[model samples]
Target: MSTIKRDKGLDNTLKVMKEGYLYTTNQRNRLGADNIFETRGLGGKRVLVLSGKKAAETFYDNDKIERKGTLPKRVVNTLFGKGAIHTTTGKKHIDRKALFMSLMTEGNLKHLRELTRNHWYMNTHRMEQMDQINIYRESIILLTKVGTKWAGVQAPEEKIEEIATDMDIMIDSFRGLGTAFKGYRSSVKARRRVEDWLEDQIIQTRKGKIFPPEGTALYEFAHWEDYLGNPMDSRLCAIDLMNTFRPLIAINRFVSFGLLAMHEFPVSREKINNEDDYAYMFSQEVRRFYPFVPFLPAKAKTDFHFDGHKVDKDTMLLLDIYGTMHREDVFENPNEFRPERFLDWDGSPFDLIPQGGGDYYTNHRCAGEWMTVIIMEETMKYFAGRITYDVPEQDLRVDLNSIPGYVKSGFVIENVKENLDRR
Candidate 1:
């Protein structure tokens, strides 16, 4: 049996927070392990950090690993919400995941695409009248409208804006601590407000006071029965509904990253406009190349041997998402930004996992990942093909030390013009 190398620290929680996306990758490099290593996480709890394709396969295997009770209380409270499908296991997970997957059908995703493009047209017109705009902040507002409308979530414009801002806070605030404690507190408050509104919507839907369409996320979740065949709790239903809207809005981060990629690589921008398949390639690369999800949390379901190392029941594990995608073994010249790499790439779920690695239906892989790709591809087409804008001088660097990092200057653009002929 090969011994797993361990980090020499009492607790590396602070280091994980400070190092952000690179924490486990750096540890794996230092330990000279390709797939597995041991480290102490919060309060010195033994954590097995796993990386690479083989490690992801082991981490996602349901017979070996499970998600229930693995996430910290803080993450549950703010990011995923209590009783989210992300926290379920076994049959409960499949039942809950079914509700999410139903919304990702061919017809449904096509509607989402149209909605995104329509919103982009509005945004482009709005941008034409302004001198300069930051794509990150602007996209938060734009995607918020697209997400709510597509989910059949009806609310006053003001209420939509409020909830959207709160959702943004929830994602941004999840990684902060110590001097950044206020952001975390704000996330709690923001989540509470969003859930309160959603719970009310669920109640109203059930009572027939409001009517969301049959195929919509809000309607389905409000009426969804549990694995035992009881009506889902309104709170749980609300969380499930949020599991739809939140990730849709979260796609704005990838949009920002995509714009950064286009700016950094002008050839990518050109290819997106001229080459029919390049938009898809560029979107895939954006997901693979950037930092979105830092890691995934799970635990051993029972005692098992992984890669000749013994993993006991209830042992905590952290899967290194960012590191695996960038490994030299996974992709040639892994650090370089090139969309062409994906052109010849085999569609291995484990290799390019910005969303996650595994089968979408049977694993914990994100349900909205397909939708994320479509929206990004459309956004790439819109920015590269339908509009002309000038990149002003500013900080384009995305700081890797931050969780879910974005371009520092928010990818600022000026002198925007709409290309009506292209439209």
Candidate 2:
């Protein structure tokens, strides 16, 4: 329902297109079309995947187009309509994206990259003696802690703990909804809680003069854009940081997924002797195959024709990254895990986007993509090569539910992680 329209109105094709999801030819046609073209996924939708790319382009050029469609106002207030990312056109979308991109510079990302390594250090050492551990719990806390450093906020330790718990609950609400009387509820509760906390902290910061360099992301957001009515709207600023933090640190999940992927393709580990090389190729490949957000839903700013079909204003489109990555047309032997595919025969770099491509327009298109690589690279170096890890055997099922994994016990990389800085 994120981008797949759940509205009462709209035709079948639009609805299906908006859903932007695909299914295997064997399953019942969710669209009722006889020809459910086989896509990169076993349960892949061909039409959805192609439309994903087209919508990104359309939204990128919003001025030339008109975005008049309705969006899920209840979920996301920012980047919702054509004016927002989901429905904007032309220079408007690009300009906003550029503004967001500015926050993620190589210089700024350098600090973030180092921070990622430190986060790993903290989490890895926390369970140095534990035989079996939960990587997700450790990683999520690491992200929250790291995000605070970037935001420049310094709440009490208790406050940080409470806020982190609130955010987790809010995130889980999405998956928890289906079980209650065959209905579902989006978990914005945690978001709201965090917002309230941010409000309190923002007000406190404005009243005081404390802009630390390792400040909270809220400080960055507040100061990034030119001051308008109020020069110190910390709540809005905090929301910006939280929003970006939630998705931006998605690299943490990618780190986990990348480790899991490498576990499958054991030979890939030898390449990690060079951390930089392994980080780039492995993170890129794993992201391409198992993108954190598989399908991206965007709104078209104007009426346009794509792939021989006419799309109306504000039409919802699904970007099928999962299927698209596996497109036989793009990758050679799509299913195989070949990190070398990214490495040119001459070893020159090629364009590979597990994050996204075609103007980089997508809902979960994280701002700190470079940081993702840094974290993954450091993590791989620690476990895959520098430090050996023993991965417990487990079954991996394509968890349609979330970006990470929907398995009973996600992957556990254990071997008493200690002294990672052998370099």
Each prediction's RMSD over C-alphas, in Å, is 1.7, 6.7
lDDT of 2: 0.51
lDDT of 1 by residue, 36-140 (tens): 899987678999988888888888788999889888777788888998988888888888788889888788899999998888987877899888898888888
The parts of candidate 1 lying over 4 Å away from their true place are 177-180
* Candidate 1 RMSD to the correct structure: 1.7
lDDT of each: 0.86, 0.51
Model 2 scores a TM of 0.74
Pairs that collide in candidate 1 are none
Displacement of the residue 210 alpha carbon in candidate 2, Å: 3.1
